[model samples]
Target: MTDSRPRGRRQAEAERNDRALLQAAREVLAADGAHASVAAIAARAGVGIGSLYRRYRTKDELFQRLSALSLDHWNAAAERGLAADDPWEGLAAFITACVEFGQGSLSPIAGAIEVTEKMRAKSDRGDELLDALVARAREAGALRPGVTAVDVSLLVEQLGTSPLLDQLRRQGRDDLLDEAAGARARLVAIAVDGLRAVHAEPPPGHAPTRRLYTERWRRRPEPAG
Candidate 1:
């Protein structure tokens, strides 16, 4: 006999399950650190271990899905920033979003609570999108000129790692985090201005000026907010 349950009911159930699992995973990772096991996650989800296994075959797979979900969230936030009519404003918004996302996230899933190489690679892989955005904005004269696609992409990730930046915000240090967020926003705007394609002629066919953009390479801390 065919069941007469509404499709809406099934979809809602699935969503609830996904949310439970995601939340459970976060709790397990946080409580146990990187050594958190699948059993722990299952218990946290209040689901049978088999159910957890059904959704995520391996720990790495589970994390990869979680990581992807996290990225999608931040990326969506970035897109929201891009919705501004002015390109400079859009870029600034995206940069702020990126910084805030990093400060708030990157602790769960990995258990180690740092941006992993895998996640960093995902961000690095967005070069084409960043390049296209920069090109269009520069051509539209939103940028001040002389800035390149590579410059904006690299800096967005680098400046976002400010240890002092995310921590203050997460620790309820709203004043300092607000202070840093504003400063970072301005930084993005300056870079955008520098990158805008200028109408003025260069000395000749001047090569793109590439210099020290990031002084700090080592990993820094911040709460993903």
Candidate 2:
């Protein structure tokens, strides 16, 4: 006899399949960085490219999903880190987790970075969990007030894998394997301190120099003697 489930259950199973396919895409991207191919991802997911496209219209959509997955993992790690009792230790753990996650798990790209709105949306959907944690720390004097979660997010992006990480890894400098780990922790600490510092905000009406439009006169070549 064949076992049968309700029609609703069948739909749920299909949804699960779709999710699995997308997750497979994430795995492929992380392992190969930006070089992942749809065919390879489909094969890894035990599905066909057509099926994958049915779920994701193009590689761009797939990359968006990959960005979403990366942020989800990071947000979860942050939650666990913030749960620690010691504020400083919690912050340190958070930075370390960020380093660990970014090392080989994320492919840095200008395009992928543009998906930050998707990241913020996903994180916000979780009751602003990560943001709330940071806000709580700031409120408790553990972190500096006026330090938006956006600041922390941007800092992580700035300190993550340099072009050098891959270069060094390729060169067999195993010692540099976790060197950024400590530096990451210190960087986060400095950002927090700056936020907490009582330095006044720039005085009203004082604008930052706009070097974008200004050009320095080129030094004139010495007249041929």
Candidate 3:
């Protein structure tokens, strides 16, 4: 019992440290992007640099985990949306959940981290869930004919950039933070309304493809020697 107790406590502490590190990394990266230092993240997490390095050898490793967590959040939200009875409401709910969760703020660190197979798999699954959700909405005539799943994905990404979250942290403006969130919610609502099958002119140029969006995050191949 004594041996197991110690091990369990150690595991619990390790998990807590990881959560703190991730939240700190997210905040620091959001404010400073790829240029942010590991020391900054450690300090923000109230841990020493040595402790942070013990878990993540480099900033990329840390960001890789962050990306995975973001994908997890997205996938969960997508699932919840798909389970909703109202197709349009489900889609809108998913979009709002993603944006409000600050998943979009992680985009700046995309190229900095190695896009591993696990990350790719999670992202692809997210795509699948999104495709199913969009199909449900479209078949029900809740979505505009011209809109695509990729379009909704891109729109959520665009809305996910939460600069106000950073501001709320730095400036301690909790009062204004709620106001800012409300404004964002209002914008998202308008965006959802626009996605309805009502009259609208065709968007200029062709709609963006999932391939194009995915490729943007991939590391470019090196030139021949």
Best by lDDT: 3
* Each candidate: RMSD: 9.3, 11.2, 3.2
Sort order, lDDT high to low = 3, 2, 1
Question: What lDDT is obtained when candidate 2 is compared to the true structure?
Answer: 0.60
Q: Assess candidate 1 and give its TM-score to the true structure.
A: 0.47
Q: Provide the TM-score for each candidate, comma-separated.
A: 0.47, 0.50, 0.88
Return the TM-score for candidate 3, rounded to 2 decimals: 0.88
Q: How many backbone collisions does model 1 have?
A: 13
Off by over 4 Å in 1: 1-11, 23-36, 39-48, 74-83, 100-125, 136-225
Ranking of models by TM-score:
3, 2, 1
Model 1, 3-56: lDDT tens per residue?
A: 578999977876787779877775555456557888888877888888777777
Model 3 regions more than 4 Å off: 1-5, 199-204, 220-225
lDDT of 3 at 65: 90
Compose the digit string of candidate 3's lDDT tens values, residues 1-225. 455567889888888999999999888988998778998999999999998999998888898899999999999999999999999899989998998888777877656668989999999999999999999998998888688888888888788776765778689887788788788788878877788877465456788898866767876555599
Model 2 TM = 0.50
Instruction: In angstroms, give how far residue 182 of model 1 lies from its true place.
Output: 12
Each candidate's clash count: 13, 0, 0
